[model samples]
Structures are given as C-alpha cells and as structure tokens.
Target: MAASTKNVSVGTVETRGIEPVPDSERHGHAGQMFWTWFAANISILGLPLGATLVAFRGLNIWQAALVAIVGSFGSFALVGALSLAGKKGGAPALTLSRAVFGQRGNAGPTLVTWLSRVGWETITTTTAAYALLALLGVAFDVRQNSFLTVLCLLVFIACTLLISGLGHATIMWINKWATVLFGVLNLIVMGFLVATVDWSKVLEAPAGPSSGVIAGIGFIAAGTGIGWANAGADYARYLPRTIPGRRLVTASAFGAGIPLVLLISLGSLLTAGDPSLATSSDPVSAINAMLPSWMAIPYLIAAFGGLLMSNHLSTYSAGLTMITLGLRVPRAWAVVIDIVLMFLGGIYFMLIADDFYGPFSTFLTLLAVPISAWIGVIAVDMLRGRDYDPDALMDTSRTSRYWYTGGFRLPAVLAWVAAIVSGLLFTTAGTGADDVWFSGPLADTWPGVNGLGWAVSIGVGAAVYAVFGGRGPITTPASSPALEESVR
Candidate 1:
C-alpha cells in the first residue's frame, strides 16, 4: 500500500496503526454508534437464526421471541463493554486484548477472531450471490446453473473488495445509506409478514425442553454478538474520549440489540407459517416471495445492501486482526490481504463446509464460543483495572510490558485454551444435542445439553483469568512520543 492512503483525513485520521486517539483528536459522539451497529447488524442475516430456534430447536414463536429478546441483551452487553474499550484506550479491540493475552499469546485469540470474520464474510458473500442469482431469475429470466452461481459469487466479492478497498470512511458512508435503504424496505416486508402469517400455527408450535431452549438462546446470543466481539473498538477507537461510557454502552447495546430482536422476531414469524424456512434458497428471497412482483427486485437490492454493509466492517476488522496478530504491513495492505484471504476462504467453504453444516445456527453457535471467552477475559481485566496501555500493545519491541515472557502470557493462554476446549467438548459442535464434537462426561450424561459448554466457557474463562491474570496494579499511561506526532 502507498503512503497516500494514510493521514488523508477524508473519512478518518486514516493512519493504520494502534496509536492512541489523542484528547485533541477525539471528537465524535456516542450516538453515532447507534446507527453504526444498528445498521451493520440489522439485516436478513437473522432469518436463519430465528428459524433455527423454531424449526430445529422446537421452540414455539413466543418461546423463540422471548429467547431472542433476552439473548440479545447478553450478547450486546458483551459487545458494548468491549466497545467501551475503544473510547478509553483509543486502540483496536484486538490491540487492547494484548494486555490480557500478552503479545504472542494474543495471537491465539486473534486467529479465532480472524476466523470469525472470514466465516461471516464468506457466508454473507454466498448469501448475496444467491440473491443475485434469484434476482436474475426474477427479472432477466436468466438460467440458474453452477457457472452463474460461481460468477455471481465472484461479482459480489469484487464489489465488496472494491469499495472496502477505498477504506474506512467509505465503508461508514456506504453502511449509513445501506441501512436507511434496507431498514425502511425490510420493515415493510416485516409488516407484511406480521399482518399475513397465521398466529394459530405459531402459537401451537411445539415447545421443546429447557435444554433446547437454553441452546436456542445461546445460539441467538452468539449470532448477535460474535462478529462484533473483537471489532467493537475498531470503530469506536476514533470516537472522542469525551463521550461518556454510558452513552457508548447504551448506543452500541441497543444499536445492535434492537435490530436483532426485530429480525429474529420476523424469522420466528416466517418459520411459523413457512415450513421450509430453514431450507429456503435465500432468506431475502423468502421475504420477497411474500411481496408483490413489483417489490421483489427493490427488496432484493435492499437486503443485498445489508451484506455489503456487513462485509465492509468485517473486512476492515479482519485487517486490524491481522495487524494485531503481527502482520507487519500497513493497515491498507492488511485490508487487501484480508480481502484476498476471505475470498479464497469463501471458495473453500463453498467446496466443503457443508459436510458438517446441519443448521446455519449450529455453525454460528460454535463460532461464538471462543469469542465470548475472549471478551469475558477482557472484561474481567478491565474490572480489575490493570494496565491496558495502548502504546504497549502497539509496540513491536520487547520494552513493552504486554510482551510478557517471550510475548506470551501464560495464565491468559491457559485460560483461553481451557475455556474453548470446555465449550467445544460439551457443546453440540455437530448437528444434534447428543452430537458433541468432543463429548464430555457432563454432556454424555445429558443428551439435551447442547450449548451449556459455551456459557460455561465464559464464566470459567473470566473467573480463572481474574484470579490468575488481574494481579498487577494498574499502571500509569506510558509516555508515547508517537501520539504527539501525526501518525498519518
């Protein structure tokens, strides 16, 4: 990447490193986060999330709705708390994570975060590609074949990469309009479903046991919070430190939480009437099917915009995660690398992820575990008031305190590994509740214990890290000459 991309001040300060947002440079409001997260998360993505609870988890509409509302709170709490780190630390979330994970130790969790972004981007890419194919069928009467599918998939990637290639300010602008365009249009579709779907069936849908309900809520929470867990601070890092923590928290929590509740409610409603909700070709198309002929293309365009909006954020964060994981490249170059990696990874998933793909809900639930654990540990670190010096995290040299013992923090690493392993072994990483990928004794004893492992992982990881890791007294901010200079 050229030096030209940095310090332009078009959309941002635009420098690509973990320098602190000096008090003078901090100037944005917390309220902006409302649209930032709301627009980014509220989308067609929730369709499968809601449908999985109703169709696969055996939850009735009310039960699923209850879970959706409740679970999103927990998810966004994690999101908001981590997001608060940005205003306080003025560093990327993964950068702040170096405090807990140490320099090299953070790589473990960073890779997990990177995988989360790639998995999400790939899935959304596939979603948009399918919608493009459907639009072709609806408008141009084009044939659907393997070649067209691949071609459309490539087209979606090209567009996402091209725009994301322009960088952060552009992504923010795109997300702003994308949200406005999609929000009104999708709300109309939701209203149509609300007025049309038969309530009796939704009410009479069979409710499963407590275990399944727990899993359903866990799945939704993970889906709601996973993508943003490691990226919250990335956007907030540029915000003015004058913003109150409460404002930031409320803005992010509800910003993301509200849309999730709405969309998940819509998903549950759709599953109640549409028996094929889980098996639908594409969720937005399923919504368009409910609309009149004139509305299909317009609605499709709106929903596809959601994917573009999401991919922009994900790709941007993937770049930061790469940098956090020691990719010694400019932020712009890292983003380019992130795009290529996600593109190749999308193709790889299209080829083989389905061997294990039972429900999209399952895949998302598994992705959420390590992420939750990561945030949990970070939160505990914050509560303990240990040093989270931004400059230390950015420091490549050994002088930084975060570079603990060969750049690895032992207790934190152990805590992360223990939590993730515990989560995976007991949770249903495979299709069924009884289908533990690595069955634990507790899980084997209880067949319905699908996602207890993930919940446990969070508590266990936080507790262990709190005991072992948060021992140091908080240190004063390290003097950084770099922050005084224009990093751009």
Candidate 2:
C-alpha cells in the first residue's frame, strides 16, 4: 500500500491488461495526480495555442493571459474531478463508458475517445518531429526532407512508444521526473522571454478581426481545456482508495492548470511583443531564437520530453480505449496498434499535409464538442453516485447491465448525437483566418457569433439525458466466465 504522506515503491508487479488496479496494488497519494496530468500537458504545442489567441484571435497579451488562466483552471478542474472516479472504480476512463453506454452501447463513446486520443497522439508526434527537425537543422545543417524528417520522427516516437507499451505505472513514473525537469526548464525559459519582451507592444496589439475574441475563447477555453477529459481517469486509476475525492480533484486541477496558464501566457507574451513570431514557419525555432545559444538546445530537448509525456499518455489511453471497444487483445498489444496508427498518421502529416497548423487546430477543435458532451454526461453520472462495478465494465454479453435496447443506451446516445450535430452546425471553425466562419443559422445573422457551440452541445446533451432518465435503464448479468477474463 502507498504511504499516507508520499508515494511508496510498488516495484514491478504490474497488473495484467485492463484489470482493475487492485487495492493491494493501489499505492499513491492523490497529489501524484498533479504531476501526472500536469506533466502530460506541459508542451510547446501550447505555445502555438497561445500565439493563436493573441495574433490570430485578436486578444491582447493581458486578455489572452486572463482567458488562459480562467479556461485552463476550469478545464483542469474538470480533469481533476473526474480523477475521483478512477480510484472509485479501478478502470480506465474509456472502460467506464460501459456504465453510461451499455456493454455494446459503449462502443460509441469508445470510438470517439479512441479516435480523438489517436489524433492527440498524432499532434504530440508531429510537435516532437518539429522540435527534432529544428534541432537537426541547426546542429547538423540538415534542413527539411521527407527521409531525414521521418528518420527523426521514427527515432523519437520509438523511444516514447516503448514506454507507452509498458503501460500505466511506468507512464506515471516518467511523468513525475519529466515534470520536475521540464517544469524547471520551462520556467527558466519563460523568465528569459519575460526579461527580453517589450510590454508596450503586448498591451497595444489589437484583436485579429470580427468574432476573433470569441474564437480565441473557444480555442483556449473549450479546445485546450478539455483535450485531456477522456484520458483524465486513465492516470488516476491507481490512486489508493484512502485518498479523498477532493484531494484527487485538487491535485489534478492544479497540477495541470498552473503550468498551462503560465506557458500559454508566455506564448501570448511573446506573440504580443513581436507580431512576427506568430507568422514564423518553424514554431520551435521561433521560440529557440529568443533563448541563449547554450540554453536553446536544452530547451528543445525539454520540449521533446514534454511531447513524449503527452504522446505516450495518449498512446496508453488509446490502448485502454481499444480494450473498451470490446477488442480481445492484451493492453500492451493494443498499445502496439496505437503506435502503428500514430506512426502512420505522423508519416502522412510530415509528408503530405499542406496546411499543418490549420488542419491540426481544426482537428483539435472538432473533438471538443463531443468530448465536452461526453464529460458532461460522465460528470452527471459521477455526481449521482460512486457506485460502479469494475468487473462488469468488460462485460459484453446481451445480459450485461449496460446493455440497453439492442446494446445501446438510447437517451445518452441520442443526447450525444444531438449535441454533436448542434456543435457542427453552429461552430465557426475552418482552415484559415479569412475563411473561418460560423455555419449555424444563428451565427449567420449575428456574424460575430463564433465560439461556445461546445457549451450548447454538452448542455443540451446533459439536460436531455437527465430528463429522459439515463439512469433508469434495467440491469442484468453476464453468463460467460471466460468472456469476463478476456476484454469485452
């Protein structure tokens, strides 16, 4: 068991694929969650997000800072609150979908989480590739090429993939050490940026165009805030039962929230000071320009480490998501599939993706709607009660309790679909600044109405589900003992 005050060494007796983190094995303070989720999010990818807010969204540095603070805090707070469920039921977040969606019904949310996390892994990989490419270009004078860039991609992703294939305990340990090192490096780098920046420009920079501020709000508040929602419980499943739910939530929120606000603000600060940095072709190199030569390489390395933290965590959760899809495979093997998919996607983006930032940003924004609604449903379920059967989560038979009308929970699915449709119709997201426009009828008239479609999606879904009695579904039991041993 974990010591009450600190994490104790559980040493190498890792559980099998998708098994509940048994009480004997559960040993860690809730505070460890702070490092887990926090470390997962502290990356240079956030820099571009901040830049988009100031340079593209028309927010001043101070306004961007305010948005980052509020958005990140609320987002991470949701992440942390969800962590309580992990310890309550020793299963991954995706696995827990069985409670909301039936055993067969769970496939819907599982697919969404799986696809989104895979997308996130792709981003993490692309960001790392960018960093390594920049580092190689500067160090060995090797500029962009499909072969050399892919080589860096494979090498860097491979290292993190190996760790990902190892699964949760290993992931948490890596995040702990990584957060300490990268956290310090990022702070020092920010200090440098702060010392060099001219605050006069930061304060004077005007907003981008019409609906810019709202778009920025949507990007940071919803887009960046809830990216980790599906995976929050993945890291928290191992926390000891002794830890209070309040601590779990607090540790998780602060762990992820603080660095996000700080780093995102620094990006805003940089872009506000020099508008040119926003348009720079190479993001890592752009930031590297501000640092001293001695510290530049180390910062890149730290940024790469941050990428691994987010990438492998996504990989790990993607594996759980696959298992949640009722796939009969070892969790490590699921991770292998995730790696292969990520590697393939990474190759495509590096080779053929013409507009990288535009597509990536859009890709990130696309999932926020579904994820927000899904989290809303989950948070509602969590608030109702702590009761859950960890073993039943993998139950896939017709008799499983989660099996509603033809293996789907009608209300939850309908709510989710309705919310997603509304979001898609109303959301003002597109390829570039000039082309970006809201599609909904409401937005058509207002013109300046761009952001917060996610709220409508999630709110409507949650409200519908509640009114329709999502919790009223009848329960049943599985008949196959062997099936219980295998993943759903």
TM-score of each: 0.90, 0.89
TM-score quality measure for candidate 2:
0.89
Scored against the true structure, residue 251 in model 2 reaches a CA lDDT of 82
Query: Deviation in angstroms for 234 in model 2?
Result: 1.1
Instruction: Give me the candidate number with maximum lDDT.
Output: 2
lDDT of all predictions, in order shown?
0.72, 0.73
> Per-residue error at 336 for model 2, in Å?
1.4
- Residue range 1-488, candidate 1, lDDT tens digits: 12223352445535556555656666567777777787777668887788878877888887887888878866776777778777677778887888778888888888888888887887788777767877898899998777787787788887877666666566656666768878887787677668767788877777777777777877777777755777888888777655667777778778878888888887888888886767664565667677778777876776777777778788778887887787778777777787777667655555445522354445666776788678668778766655457557667568887888898888888888887776666665555556545445566545226565667778878888877875754555663433322111
For candidate 2, write residues 1-488 as lDDT tens digits.
Answer: 11112222333423356656666777778778888878877888778778878877778876787778777877787887776667767678877777776776677778988989888888778778888987787677777888888887898778776787766667778888878988887778778778768888876777555356556666776756587888777877777766767777788778877888888888888877776667765677788888887777778888888888778888888887887786677776788788888888888777877666776766776777788778777777666553556556656677666677888887777777877777666666667758663356554533226567777777777787777744532332432332222111
Query: How does residue 218 of candidate 1 score in lDDT?
Result: 72
lDDT of prediction 2 = 0.73
Q: Each model's number of backbone clashes?
A: 0, 3
Give every collision pair in model 1: none
